[model samples]
Target chain A: MRAAARPGGKVTIAEVAARAGVSKGSVSLAMNDKPGVSAATREKVLKAARELGWLPNQAARSLSSAATQVSNIGLVIARPARMLGLEPFYMEFVSGIESVLVERSYSLLLRLVHDVDEEIGVLDGWGRSKQISGSIMVDFTVDDPRVAPIAALGLPVIAVGHPDLTGGLPSVWTDDGAAVTEAVRYLAALGHRRLARVGGPATLGHSMIRSEAFAKAVADLNLEPGRILPTDFSGEQGARATRALLASAQRPTAILYDNDIMAVAGLSVATEMGVSVPAELSLLAWDDSQLCRLTHPPLSAMSHDVFAFGAEVTRRLMDLIDHGDAEVGAVPTPVLVPRGTTARAH
Target chain B: MRAAARPGGKVTIAEVAARAGVSKGSVSLAMNDKPGVSAATREKVLKAARELGWLPNQAARSLSSAATQVSNIGLVIARPARMLGLEPFYMEFVSGIESVLVERSYSLLLRLVHDVDEEIGVLDGWGRSKQISGSIMVDFTVDDPRVAPIAALGLPVIAVGHPDLTGGLPSVWTDDGAAVTEAVRYLAALGHRRLARVGGPATLGHSMIRSEAFAKAVADLNLEPGRILPTDFSGEQGARATRALLASAQRPTAILYDNDIMAVAGLSVATEMGVSVPAELSLLAWDDSQLCRLTHPPLSAMSHDVFAFGAEVTRRLMDLIDHGDAEVGAVPTPVLVPRGTTARAH
Candidate 1:
């Protein structure tokens, strides 16, 4: 099934054997460089493999033979280079991955791409060239194009996304939909009638899940739907979105930001405009970082252990590398942590 | 001189040729994999190279042949993995490096270590195995133990420190001594009789350079040397240092933080303790990030273009990889950008 799902469709050892006019065991023997297969039959099997563009599992290959599989794991992120520096989520995630990697003395091969296509190419090249033993994929979008090419190459990967979006890749994700629902319910319970959400890019799978959950929660509570303004997860964009929302005639009493950096920026916008926080505007940040505590009036956040999440993803990847299969599931639900920023609606 | 300074010291192609009982040109041809070398001569030359632990210039080898040179560059940091998550310096620096690396479509191999010894082992393994084309080295301590092993391996490297501290490796650095002098002069000019600095760890080369410069500046200005507290550059440590300073019977009228996170934490400390910025106390932060701007009364800082510095370091490394040599020099001086945090001493 997985071979069929690859870029050019599923290619199996049986298919290779049939095309080569040899038995499956003979084909395997030829492919594995073992004896009992004639040179001509071996050549036919090799030709069929080349023609079919079949990729054997490098991890499995390394286990059977003395092939020099690089003790490096590739991580390709499609993000603006400037934003990557300031975002606490990525830094924390990378640190978490390193915690596990250091135990095995493995290195991380990090690459930043402008889009998903680039990420796929980079991963495919790494797989074909044997540059890494495994890879961890993050920031999945709807129907991510990276899935097929990666699966086709049979590269061991641990995807950071919901199962629906990962296309059968072993995935680790926080329950974003559940977290969004919780955030909205908490704000509603605080007697806030109108709520707004500052979301990340519309293209991201997690952002889409959060947005849909927000809509559902609003309808379920019979409250006015919060305006969800998509942003690139930069502080400047966060501030701009906050300014626009506040300037509107029917402004929300509370705002939920997708990340802490943007939430901090939104807070700054409120202060700049002389809007009293919690008294008039309640701000909540996601992926609670130390930035929440450092602000003038500390921010309330949707708190989860991102470091632990990263470690969990890395653990799954290591398992995939060693045992050749892993369970895909959500790690944990983010809890609403109350702080100075969020209070009873006045 | 660099050859003599290597670990086993003074290994040369001529010495290798004499040991192999071949001419120097034959040794060169064999090492470079050129057509002029015979099979037996090439074997002897390679054996001699192994016996002497000499590695030919990898960049040259890549240029001449279709060797599977990994399209990756190695970066190893000797720091606690937890701290790396919160530190903006490395993220920004890494972003800058990405700005250049992206253009060439190369991957960055990142690793974190507990100390210099671990860092040395990692780099040695990478060099010996050709896991990377080159590497970037940072955080040089006084008499850094990493230099000799790295140099002996003849791996192309770009050291991120002053030349005096980098042991003959091509380096890219900011003038920390000058930046310290400027910060001190700025504070003294504001009529602050007592000045203190929250510096990074004492073992770091840059920290020592800044400390000595601070002492000289204090003496030249006819003022007593203010206390310098060393920290691990964490916000919590910064807050603790600030609390201790403010609680002292002879508190400093002004304080300088080594980084923006620490300065922001110190600002929070001042507010919580009923101290006023630029009124009863003056605060200055280093490495001005967007965090400096987001605070209530924006922080004044010694600002430098860290992204450009990272880019410059990468450029020099690319040069080193391409040409087998590069020039070492300071990138730029950090300028004092005054904001609300600094004011005249009352």
Candidate 2:
């Protein structure tokens, strides 16, 4: 009855029943979704299978497959899950993806990897055998190696990043350059001459765009472009950067962070160092997560409609995967959410 | 070379190639993960699938099966993915489980569900089929019906909840009664005359214990317990409860929340209503997620190490599933984390 060699042999239904604390009949009832078993009991049977580390038998798989199928979509986060959490943009964006995916009875295969190489490997493995029908790619760096890897293989994929990085992949992106210009212009309008930015890793295309835009804004304002402190999007790094920035001789009254978590960390660091927010220093954040709103004085943020962006990207990916001819991609706009963190220069 | 009747056969790869502005060989390279196609061309192939409503045949399933060889554990979150994002407990707990599962070459089949009923189907149907070995169950209630379903089917399951709800199955639980008692005693010791608790949903067994314990403490201390406001653990519910309490003339100086998210909502409500924390009012949070530490001045909490709890639960489940002769359950204890939110009652 067994098709192939597994490291472990098949576990009997009796063992599954024993582990679930139910009878074999209960297991059979749950497996069949018959009226005999209660909802709670069915869950227990399922839980027992999980605990036993059981896989589906051929018969069970065939039975379940006939009714409902699990749709898989590959997602390579391009960062550790912990770091990804710092940017509320991810959660909202994921929520958006889930909003659509759930409706379509699709499931997400999410992975957190350290580098672009690993990300590409994950994609190659997921796509080649059809573990997923399609996949989404993020965090495009200039001259990204993944672009060539994907292009050469002709894998079915969507790039949620810069078009320049993909060498022609269907891309859905936020206008980071435009958003950075707006953030800088706002700082200038506040009569702040010197401004500093705590940014994400330098390898990210969005970071590069923001960094270049920040430089251009500084030159346009004739204000000290000040310094660009690149960070790994870690709260600890943001705290240290804020501490060092404060001790500088050319201290800036205004500071902008790449994401909300960093801004929150910066707030804690600034408060510890006896810097008064908005009075002695002004703070800003990008990717306005709920953390921005929860701060003692809320954080002013350069917010994009991230949830909508996710939905749009998902729609595009689905389209690219399902339709032979579809409109390729779109560049989303951004808006600034004003909270308690920013004010006119003191 | 054709297998069973397949859907995608009618639409030849040539049609996809013709519509995608690429050659058939480029399309083949993209589909096969062979070099020669560009990232853009690959995206064209993927986009075509989405547009054409094509589901790759055995591509994803066969591919993933070859790479993982990892044992699977099904996890039904029993909550929407968005809410799951806000709760730090899941992030930490899942990490804890993964920290151990990875070593065993076990992967978690994580799903976010809207209700308990949907979960039953997931387990009985998808979870029953070789998707996972055993599943983890959480938030047990009195007269939990899952016990019977699992018992009947005889599936191997481990519960990260109470024993009774697990239907005498191996379970891991927190000592919520003792934790609640300690919280009330602490408040009473602080000279507070009135106490109130914003607890989780009534259907959850943990909430029942916490509520009962809170009631007993109030009666023993000769303080008015008033009411246990049970909520769905949403931010809006927390805000509404806080407002109602604040409007009351018998406003208690001390308020305890079932979770960090609700506590955060309470903090916001208090702030929005001009109530100074620990000065005009005091707050306490249970479960001790990271949000407590990140909040302004930090939140005082009844803390238990959830990461450890998750790990312990996983281990216990494995024990039951593997050996079937072991101490099936252990209840963890909670200690108070005295941060800035709680102080001597005014």
Candidate 3:
């Protein structure tokens, strides 16, 4: 056995093993409470470790071959923190991610960045520092700059966006285009010709996809050209878009929103403007949170289980980390749930 | 100089220093970009580190005397993840905490546990592993079991609850008691004799504080005995409590909710039951989230800036970490923000 060498007077595991009259490997198994160690040996190791005042330094353990013992998964969200707080999608998604992570005794290292560039920097730092085992990337845009650099880092990652936008990265995504088409078809079936969509920033990959799908759906139904107004996904902006659509020369009979908060805001705006819901205007919301049910004329929504989506994404990432690769797939498309906010157009 | 020793074939700073023909301290200074190293020395160290493919391991650095280099702050929320996502207060508070942390280039290590016992375990692990420099504890209940164990861990923590509940930990809290009293007085001034309060779980420290204050305020104002119902802070429970209150033998002329979600839920229940808000029933909400403004007859609220409050708690934690102590103080109390949902009872 090696003699105790207290570097900077801090107790080392080797010293504990030396004191316990066991090999370093036995000490590790005993400390971690893994199998292959007898109860007597484990007790002796624990007593020696206690007497030596040795706390298992996870940092040192990470440096050795036991890197798998470090259980931290990174999630970098590229959005304004203020806006992120109000959006139910992320919170629910994180909760879903947490549900899966807790089962494995892994922790999620969450960071909110201003943009993709900042997110890349954060991810790169985490990768080099070995602070995270894997990462989940969100909010992909057209020709996302993060794809190339992040891929080069060779860190296990799961991108949460369209396959085209993710640049061949392993990804789990929702078919927003299909969901949008379904929503338009449902509204058209209800005898709506003049349709409008209040979308998120046009630069967002999913938003652009939804916009294109909306236009195609309108054309296919032989309806007038659909109006698409983009916003920053804020309630105030959603209210403004609703007002503009209502006050237009040829006011649309139906409006679709990118999220429930904006949909709720549009509902309030309709009430304030004395425009009756489902009578003068039919409103459809995306990402049906509890907010949809809490509204007066509970909103119709293109609803998908976001919590399940989050769980699926996490499961894929975990698979990638454990088995070195995971299959790329699409989650369930959002389906139209016709609530009080939609009715036959007059 | 000592020859290169690759125990696990991982390049160390000592190897880099030997290759650079400089001291290990100079190599560290150059790598961290700290002052005291000359420009030429810095360049030499960088070149050697690059040639050796040496990436500074943060975990190893944390184990060394430079433990301050690790910049993680722990935040554990002891609530069900499902409920946490729907509550805007926590997300906004986290965002606020992040805002302050970003300025200092620190990161928040967030976790959601089942209860206080789980939270204590998580905190203890974090403390022992040196994964976090400090932590922020929230959701204190009566006779919080966490105080003594957590205090014993000797990790710097800022408790977000009343002093009595925090059990001598440095704390930052809002005056919920004073706010409840003021809310009762405001309703009484509006000629509301029959008032009702839908509170959070009675076991919660703040909830108990508010309950006692409500009773005292009712007695002091010579008003009718008020009805207080407690829920799990869910919108569904809020709706159920509202229905129960409205169905009572002496229906309240005014109702106050513990959160904006519950208040919004209560509003929907009132509308469903054919009760005219402010005409036959008045509603007041706590924690003025955007949901309060989105509702029809925008909810009147006991409003306080939760975002700012979160920022303040982080600042205090930072101070405690830097200065070894922080002052216990109450933030601005929630003030009445009367909007369309409140009026003089007939």
TM-score-better candidate, 1 vs 3: 3
lDDT tens digits by residue: candidate 2, B97-191 = 65556446454566666666556656655444445567778767797755544543445677677665665655667778888999999988988
For model 3, how does the per-residue alpha-carbon lDDT over A1-346 read when each residue is reduced to its tens digit? 1111122236788999999999999998986656899978877776676555464654554354322345778888767667767788887898888888777767778777666655665765666556678988888899886766566556789989988898768888999999999999999999999999999999999999999999999999999999999999989899999999988899999999999999999999999999999898999999998888888878899997887888888898898888887878788889999899999999
Per-model lDDT: 0.82, 0.72, 0.83
TM-score of candidate 1 against the unseen true structure: 0.81
lDDT string for model 2 (A1-346, tens) is: 1011122246788998999899999998786656789978977887776556453364545655534444567677656544443455676777677777766656666665555655665665665534466777888889776665564435567778766666666677788888888888888898888899999999888899889989998898899866999999877788889998999999989998997778888887787788898888889888776566666777899886666777777787787667633455455667777778778886
Q: Candidate 3's residue-wise lDDT over B217-300, tens digit each?
A: 999999999999999998999999999999989999999999999999999999999999989999999999888889999999
Which of the numbered candidates is closest to the native, going by highest DockQ? 3
- What CAPRI class is candidate 2? incorrect
DockQ of each: 0.14, 0.10, 0.18
Which ten residues in a row are the worst by lDDT in model 3 chain B?
B1-10
Clashes in model 3: which pairs?
Answer: none
